[model samples]
Target: MLRRSAVILVATLAAVAGAVSPASAGGPRHVRGTETIPVYDYGTAIRETVWVESPLDSDGDGARDRIAADIVRPREARTRVPVVMEASPYYACCGRGNESELKEYAADGTVSLMPLYYDNYFVPRGYAFVGVDLSGTARSTGCEDVGGPAEVASAKAVIDWLNGRGTAFDASGARVTASWTTGKVGMIGKSWDGSVANGVAATGVRGLETIVPIGAISSWYDYQRYNGILRTREYVRYLHSYVNGRPAEACADELAAMRAASGETTGDFTAHWAERDYRTAARNVRASVFIAHGVNDKNVSTGQFGLWWDALAKHGVERKLWLFQAGHEDPFDVRRAEWVRTLHRWFDHELHGLRNGIDREPRATLETAPGVWTDERDWPARGVRDRSLPLGDGTLGAGAKGRGVTKTFTDESLREDALVANPTAVVPGRVAFLSAPLTAPLRISGEPSVTLRIQVDKPTAALSARLVDYGTGTRVDHFRSEGVVNLATESCWGAATATDDACYLDTTEVTATADHAVLTRGWADAAHYRSLRFTTPLEPGRWYDVTVPLNTYDVTVPAGHVLGLVIGQSDPQFTVTNDQNATVTLDAGRSTLTLPATGAAVTAPTTPQSITTTTLPGAAERRATDNTPVVPLR
Candidate 1:
């Protein structure tokens, strides 16, 4: 054994040696006060705040509106970097993510706990993260115009300021210029926040290179009504109150004006809704987009995403997609690690001009189940053939010989479950039809359409069609009519701070083992069959050919399963069942259901197979009745 003094000296010398040693042999180093420090530290990010000027007097105030922005950047960014922005109204009202984090301000009005994990994850990666408060929200000065010009302009102005074309101010009210930026910008958000991104991109503003809008609304009209049928009567008033969160009297005038101009009584696509339609201005989009949406989202409707995606494709805009089966959810919660990595590469390729192979990769990523994901070269996978299945004599088949055979149903007193149950059983107020058990797996990858030739006693009636799978298996219970249950367990994603933490406990994604699963559904009014912008009521007892377009979906029906189409005159979930009960007759010879089929060629059976009469237990209730706005955090 060595002496105590010798042992102490040896330990002291080893501690000093370890303290001065570099973490890695060839790591990047920075000289600080005669010492060498490793330069790649991810925890040292700079957080600050500023206000960009907007040329909008939406509040009817004399002064122009100013948008408050919270910024975070890498501490060692010696040169200018590109920007990633999220402009939203929820930072003040509903907060963000499953935990609902609000913005925390310092004594001097500087932002502290910025909402989502964008700043916490991206700032350390040599990118600047910006959280912008929309005009009239939080510390910004103006009236929130929802999707109007004022809201769109407020976001565009921030991009302009970064590119040296607009103005911003510091905390002391002094004008400041974004001299530390490369003028490249990318915006990402969900719900209303994503709507702002879409609206701003539709303006073709300079410096807005890309956007990632998750579960966003492209048309405001579709949110409140469906094809001339009023659904949510007080959508505007409800949304205004939900976003503002201030004293109702403060914005009483604005709210009243919004309700008056909404055209709710007529349920028409008036000029007010026209201004809020991003599809009309899609030709002006110059930014590449990455779109993500839940196919089962009743709040923002999958139709909005389908229409916007189609419009962007027609305009030849570069785009990508992430379609899922959840309802009103963010992709981050569903696929966190992959989402973060994919998003990082997308921003780098679009904003930093990095030659990442993201653009060359598959254009679509679809989630089939809770932990199942698949990639495709493009959405609505190529080589889809439309198969027309006829509806006649209580059977859905490929051929219909019974011309005079007719099924009648009234426009009152029927639930969706009762309509889709036991097709062979006699059900009043609705008609149900089902195909024979599929010989092989059938995959549907696009929208399904319904063509009905009918004569009705009333001038107008609500039409609903549901595509269902009748078999015993486990699948995603998409129609969670009674919302999701949040468990006590918690999960952490990205970095966490005292004021704002990127932690969330996953909510439930309803699953069930039953006789059938509602694949997709569609609704329309008979009077608006020809045109949604205009309506012409039908003459009583006159034959009319009406086609209703159903929601888009991608699902694979297992072998031995039967495809079903349930047609009903009214669905109490959406439109109130027409009070005046009217008898409707269907012409079997002309009625057919068109499905976009994928995989092996399937010929519909000429002879109708025996219909299965199994009743699925626990029928899902209807969602979308409530007007409470859900701000999705992506």
Candidate 2:
């Protein structure tokens, strides 16, 4: 990764070196916007620390809150240039990037180790880079509201300062302004940091020309719950501590307030969650968006990005996407050179108003596997068709059942691995249905859904659908690893500072060659089958047609691979414990599994212990704690 970046950097340097004037001191000239600005040398860029004032006082401190910004910009610029900013709460705690590098404060109270390679790579390219510490984090004041208005406003305030609409101060408390910036900013980050960009963009902040949210959260509600089913009852509280890194006592009131606001008890979409949901305000977004997400991201999940992308499209917002087959990870790790070059061009077009023709390219780029990427006009590719496969006697077919058949499973405690392991295994806690080995490859490009027509014995039941690809093949092992192993040797991607090195260990992790891979999964509370904000309990002996929507995915199933759909009550690895072990009776005649298959046909045949139709008794319906600054791998 470093070697590739070095090559790109060397080329970039050569281009800039030729542009330098012979009479100029150490300044290089680059044509951006309407001016030929004197760019500061990469090795001698100005690094400074300042505090940008924010409008919120979330911590309730006597004074107004401030955001800590570590900025690197061209020292010899005669005029303002564009700015690249990253706002994050993780800097003071879990650090940033795959290496988990933290902020280092010099004895003079200036900062070093400014997270990722953004500053190292962009500062010399004639852009001012600002690494902002979100409120109540690192050197900033106020509390972290996760993705609420306070956090959004804190970051927005920095942009305002750069545009001369807000105030900033130096170490001596002297007023400072971003006179070196053109007031056009491009925000980029992964996970929570990226979410900040999403949140701020939804507010339609003026100076923010574009944003790149990689593995970012579009809705905090989705991050903690799925279709009204709680993914983790304590995730918000856990995240509060995880990002703060301070003693619990320091932010007791803030944490308490966050837990109460989450409303995990009912898993409803309250106004509190609404404040953190960017999709609800997507129409107000003025910035062009470049989104990247891992299709197999279990942490922030792909649904967040998909829903946000859809919203942006609906509002006619210019957008682009990079959908990878990896888990919660930054594209810089997966596609280093290409990611950097594309991102550079994207910023140039958006912030500098350069006619790079990037907006004319394909709207989406998808990775079928590691090292295999393809471009599409849009996501859920235009010509894909929904292939409806009905449940038959141990088979998936297009024909309706002649008689009512019921498949039952107890809502016993079981993990995802146990539920998806074997196609022939008649698991006590779940029911598995498989399609016949595909005669040809089929690519699934969008959300898949299942309709279960059933009557439950109890009032509530948790429904989990696992879309599995059962075959011996080398697939993207997103569930088990970061997919990269650290190499012993080191290399550099950007220019380095004395205390903050721009080099990271060149690493690689091989994709797992496994017999089976869990392609996509989704879960919902039967009560939430109606609406996420409202719960409707089931009436005993009465049939309810429940539609469970699975996660969004982009994958091509290999020929001869058996596509299987496993439905059950609980995944012990993901959801909170629910003790409602209700027997679920499925009317196979009325039930159907809908999938977005790229090709035309889909079929299934009977195997031992496979689903078969007949009148049957109704059965029961079911269902990383580490203090190590665990890297958000996806």
Candidate 3:
């Protein structure tokens, strides 16, 4: 697709076909390729540091903010090549990659080491690798706004400087320009790093060609707030406090502003949240997106990617998606070889101008199950449709035929582990319904919703639902570090030097045996069921129609396993927003559970059992769990 002479195209094709030209040949400027022969010595690679100026004065110093950027490039290149950049706050605080490696500086104020494998692998292959310390993190001059305008603009300013539209200064306070490289750029990162890439891409910067956001957040509001419920209060302030390089008091006012504007107490969507949401600006994106996410991610949540993908589709943006069976993890850790291979082809096709057929391939690659991957033309599996199942006395019926019986349960400060135990037995704080053991496999490819016609005894009550797959099976134990463990042995990916190496310790999946797995969950405030922007206080003892949407999922329930629906007060795993302990009564005939289902039609549910006081083996823990849930380390 590139406009070039036949000789140049054939040379590039030869490089793409694995017969990379010798190092003597001009690296990328003469022949476009990122996976080409090593044309530069990494030991002698040029390392430079710069501060890019932004439009805002986020740190209140009466001067424009400047973002710190570290660059590593091939010293042999005489002509312009492309760039692969990562803008992150983790370079100094949380570090990056499996080992949490932080940036190491040389005594001369130059970069002694670039963290992660990007510089070691790509710099010698012709791409300049730039690592930027986001605003308020590391050496950058600004306050961390969690994905607000200041953080986003700080990243965009670096890209602007690359495109000759912004100002940048060297360590010696002399102005510097990116005259040695082409303006085309690609951004890549994980978690908060990826979240920043999403924000910058949403700005439609002129020089940005593509982005690879791994386990990133698309909306900060959705990150800590699910539906109308607050997952954790003041999460933004906590994140800011962690990333800021200044003293606690130096950034105290900024953190205070974040908490005051976040509406954590009311759990409402306000203009403050809108400023951090990238989906609203998806239409402005000119760069292509390649998203990688853990289907069971709880830190950022899986809903972030689903809604962002939908919005990208709405705007006809070119994109590709990879859904894995982990939580808050990087594909590089889950699928290393494939990750490197595809990313090579992707960067080549987008940045290096290689005429690869990646664009013509399937748009989605999903790990349908453990070690099972499939490529599909579209997501939601193409034939997926919403299936409505009625809530029976103690069963999930296939049709709208349910006895006119009412069920009651009281609100309790129970965690997800306690609320889902012994689903068939009697429990005071939660009510559950079960479907027949499946004769065939049933898969759900998207979000699920639960509707209840209930009357609460208090002014406000917490509404929570869990979709569980009930069967003894092997599944990713996300509670144990996002389904991976770093081993002692290591594998090399690219070139190495005396100080920096491309080799990293390998990782493998973490799985465990389980009787029941919670596929997805949802929660909402009964008072905010009407709208997320404002609260409509409920009248005690009055029936209200409330619907809560569970987090997105793509999972299959095997034969001989039953689908279970557990309705409870809240999952203290995220947070217990309400502590009213009020009683709730619901009409079974009017309540229903809707799933994004495909495969097998259910005609009836297995008969019900009488409610008893019997509980699981750990009766005390099943009734009221005292063990705390693991918080994500991101």
Winning model by lDDT: 3
How many angstroms is residue 525 displaced in model 3 relative to the true structure, after the best TM-score fit? 1.0
Error of 1 at 87 (Å): 1.3
Q: For candidate 3, lDDT tens digit of each residue in 174-276?
A: 9999997889999999888888999999999999999999888899888878766777655777678777877677667777888898887888898889988
Cα lDDT listed for each candidate: 0.74, 0.77, 0.80
lDDT score, residue 442, model 3? 86
Model 1, 362-478: lDDT tens digits are: 999998765579999998877777888787676676654547878788765466666777766777877877676788888897778899998888877778888988887866555
For each candidate in turn, the TM-score is: 0.88, 0.90, 0.92
Q: How accurate is candidate 3 locally (lDDT)?
A: 0.80
Regions more than 4 Å wrong, model 3: 1-20, 23-35, 609-634
